[model samples]
Target: MTINVPGRFEVGTTVVRRHVWGGKVWSAMPYRVLEDVGDYLTVASWPGLRGLVSTTWIKAFLDDGHGRDQTIQELASGTWRLGWWAWQGTTVRSWYGLDAYFTVRQYFDADRRPLSWYVDFDLPKQRTRMGIDTFDLLLDLVAEPDLSRIQWKDVEEYEHGRRLGLIDDRAHQGVLAAREEVVGLIESRQGPFAHDWSPLPLEGWRTPVLPVDVRSGAVSSGLWIS
Candidate 1:
């Protein structure tokens, strides 16, 4: 695949995610650029990085008995109760490609040791003025750091979303292909597994700032003022 490198975001530059769906911002996350070279862009987030999330989306995940019904309501209403999401887990380093169908993230424990690898299937990323635009396909794959074990996550959610028409046929097809790609990467020890997993020296870096108009639901341009 001839992937074109987009305009570079300098190392340590703050960028935001526009998790877009139906031309609306479903969610957003702020990350600091770690590396931007060739076809891959590496970004990192820590415990203090603020993010935007949808409360309605959260409800759909929590209400077991009515989860499917709630999801249907969410899709039809297209309503989002946006709120702040303080980053709480350990540090995360996500590797993305503008043309790739998925993102690979390495999770670190509280002491910064490697935890595991997470593969999130998503739409091909598009570079935006704020940062990047992509939507998750509701499916994910998780593997141990040594790649000795692997399992699929969110299979039930993915299938439910597909049945509810949240994931269209085209996107469904992309997710299928991405699943195979992720497996190949694991078996070959390619992609992120090919690089050193040493923790980056982030002693002096501050948490990235969230965009000011986080509640406005405006996606694409004008997210960051700086």
Candidate 2:
């Protein structure tokens, strides 16, 4: 797969996800800039919501996943991982983030048909930026695809990390708000899980080119981010 090396993404243009905060970018996922939303820029990752949330729907429903079809969806600084005092491999291959009571995830088979949809319970995504860069707290939610299944992967370690002062708090409130909003989405099923959710990505369009930095251990890593 070939990664798009387009000139720096133009405002409102779609670009692959890089470590907006650090590490490496996921080449498979595509996101379009949606204007800087004061604290952070809002970019819509593709299949862009139309099939997921728009009236012009399809097999698409907005249950979140690694739209770029990457093996790892994220990475954090070494310090963040060290603070956790635990390891979930070194990178993210396929993962999503959630907090509060639960998080919703939509899965599909190779053919793009709905595989299973489920929720996970865990700590809310802690969003904080370092030097104008935003990143999530390094914690994870472990759950199965069974609709009613859920559990947190790391509670003590996360609390321990916080005690060690690894998590930044300036955006703690804001990140909680964000996490609440995610919960709202799962609760209401308003956007991607709407009754009309359809038009799922199929065949060649189901994924994007995997980025080199994360391609090495693609199947082994998964992340839960905010």
Candidate 3:
């Protein structure tokens, strides 16, 4: 599914992250499309954007005591209840590569100043009738807002997930390969790193709500990799 628009437009779509093992959805975040050309797609989410996620995430990350292992275990269990979540704090714009293992994100403050670059290490994205589908590997890489001085984030959780076999050999290898690809982008100033730090303008855009299928816990629509 190629998205070739004459220019950037606001898209009413969701980005769903499912577990690699059981096809259970971990999150289904709504996004406003910024740009869609060829194999790359850019989307934005602000404070009011609503989405669906596992209750485990709310307990583990939002509250306390649930820790990484329990989070991974319950997520892999594929039986957690889904709940609504809203984006808070800052504005986030995500850049997705149709066939790349990681997505690039830039954060903005209240004044719209760039904050930092967030690299989420995950399985490559697939286009679905409802939106995009992918798996989050529990690992991340962060860079300065200027897209420099990169560093690995969440190593402990990533390792723990591996130990628990949530990230199997194949997925682990994919993460390693993705690490190299992300580093190359930063080092060479390619991809999102090569662009201006300014975020895509989103004036007069309303926050998108989660898809009905996601809200109702129905199976995701058809998905296709580039």
Candidate 4:
């Protein structure tokens, strides 16, 4: 579905509690909507992580629960400008595990649906390649394995070993269980996978703590709000 906004979406505030794979849970961090430019919306977070998230990333806008939106943009360079945001504060203290600048962009199909979203991770002086890295894990979750072995341990291991250490101590188990459940649904052909993950929120979006594992060796739980 497309976002039908009269103008830009009124930026709202929410707290995003991020849990890295093997790390601690950063809680009660605030994020405020800074700009909503039709197809895309930029939001600012405390401990400061600016998110140029697609309106499509929004599962729910206000605490009262509203609809969602999408993002679409292109620059002259082959480098299509998708969205931009800035994150503040030391990465060590806040939830997001890694300390760096984060930026996100999207490529769309003729119908305006996102073909793929790319993320860039900028560290202090040190720069890392930009792109999606979790594509493999997402494939594994959707393709072959049935839901029988869906355990948090595997995800935990993967997150800890592969990405920075961040995991919600309180909701870890539940999140793992929920992951398994979503996998089961996918294996049964009841849901969408990475290839077909459209409809805004992933089938597992509402499954608390299931955030995008950023390519920066850091996993963004996307569980925070301002």
Candidate 5:
């Protein structure tokens, strides 16, 4: 389904994303909408920033109240830009765990191999008067592009989160399932992972993120700001 104006999140619009740790608000992230194409939109901190996020509000859901990340969307959309960038924040009712960033495309170079996925351990997003927000727990998981390797970063931090009751069993399991599911997609070469993900038309656009002092997270580093 395409996004129409009036109900659309227009380009150049600034949205607030908050960072959370152990269920408390640590900072607020301000980002700009770079593109608002029908199938997908891109939001980033700004140029030279390290993270990019894409996805839209929930299109539909079952009464069971299941709201997984757009891994399903990644499969169903069938339309993709041949890149593996991820963005932050969410609009649906939040889930408590890590956020998985899946890579369906890779850079076109001799060393084209890239990490297939990365998981940002964080609290689920929360809606506030200021804006929609989530917290970063500082731990992460990385998977080699070929799906042959996986590793964790900041293990101590995540352990701390569990001690604080932030990273609970449900959250941990959810994150694992997400990571496994995306790896399955890449390994099977299905859906968005089809066609080896050769580059498409991204043209001249970049992601933006707020400075560390003001706000920062997995996708906190970027080229421009809102």
Candidate 6:
């Protein structure tokens, strides 16, 4: 059987906040753009949910030239293998829950300007072990106007933990507040700002592209940024 695989993404750019969950009260995940192709893309996160994700699962947002913001709807999902540091310099390598659920959506601004972007995740149906992380970004359009700063807060929320009410309501509130704060800060400065939350790291991770050997269906060598 021939499986459909997404094409490779381009290098040196990242897309933020492509996936959103919930109906009216939505929770979203913003990812750091690793690579982008015409139809697909790749993202990376530091201290990721399951530690790391593979290149196949990351997908790009579809953009429509309309005013309404885009939304993501899951279509298919994929997984990744990750390695993490345990106690005393020990490393553990296993299948981490790094996947995406196929999605559809558009990107927009506060004024409802169309940015033409949509994002999706490739996740599995069965509950997989994972962690929850919060990422924050501060944009100063006044001084050094072109630069944006980011801060990441990693919180480990297991499936059991969530079920046990271990994921406090305050934690979720904090993320939403942070997002609003950034948006307000930008609006005050007459600058446009975008905010996103994800189980994935939105910044500080990089995946380099290497030459592929079609004969072997293997990549020669690639670089990864931590």
Best by TM-score: 1
The runs of at least 3 residues in candidate 1 whose Cα sits more than 4 Å from the true structure, single-residue gaps closed, are: 1-6, 57-76, 214-226
**Where does candidate 5 stray beyond 4 Å?**
1-8, 21-24, 34-41, 47-117, 123-131, 144-149, 189-226
Per-candidate TM-scores read 0.86, 0.39, 0.85, 0.24, 0.44, 0.21
The better-scoring model by TM-score among 1 and 3 is 1
State each candidate's clash count.
Answer: 0, 17, 0, 28, 21, 26
lDDT by residue for model 1 (1-226), tens:
1122356788888877777666677788988888888477899988987787777655654575356456445644677666667777699999997678799999998899999999988778777656777777778899998999999987887887788667777777778888888899899998777877889768898888876764344543311211
The sequence of per-residue lDDT tens digits that candidate 3 reaches over residues 1-226 is 2232333233644344333335556777878777767488888888877777777777776765456567778765666777878889899888988678788998989888998899998777666555567778889998997665988888988988778766778778878998998898899998877878675678777666665666433344212223
Segments in model 3 whose C-alpha atoms lie over 4 Å from true places: 1-21, 64-66, 215-226
- lDDT against the true structure, per candidate, is 0.76, 0.32, 0.72, 0.28, 0.40, 0.25
What local lDDT does model 3 show for residue 61? 69
Cα lDDT tens digits, model 2, 1-226, are 2222322223444333322223322223343343332322333333322111111111111333222111112122222211101111111112233133233445544344544553333233223211111133434443333324445444554455445443445334543564566445545655333423243323243323323333222222123243
Native-referenced Cα lDDT, model 4: 0.28
lDDT of 4 by residue, 1-226 (tens): 1123243334342323221221122111223333444333343322334443322223333323233111111110112222333443322111111221222323334343534433322111111122111111111121222223322223433344223222333234434454564545445644222233233222222211212433234333322211
Model 2 misplaced stretches (Cα beyond 4 Å)? 1-14, 20-105, 111-134, 140-153, 195-199, 210-226
Question: Over all chains combined, what TM-score does candidate 2 have?
Answer: 0.39
Q: Is candidate 2 or candidate 3 better by lDDT?
A: 3
Q: C-alpha displacement of 87 in model 1, angstroms? A: 0.9
> 3 or 5: which has the higher TM-score?
3
Backbone clash total, candidate 1: 0
What's model 2's lDDT at 76?
Answer: 23
Which residue pairs show collisions in model 3? none
Per-residue lDDT tens digits for candidate 5, residues 46-152, read 22333322222122123232432332233224232222133322111111211232222232322333325444554443333323455444466665655567676
Candidate 6 lDDT tens digits, 1-226: 1112333223333322211111110122323444333333344433222212112223221223231111111111112221221111111111112221222222333333433322221221111011112111111112122224333222222222234332234434433454454445444643122323213322344532211211122111110001
In terms of lDDT, the poorest run of 10 residues in model 3 is 1-10
Error of 4 at 135 (Å): 19
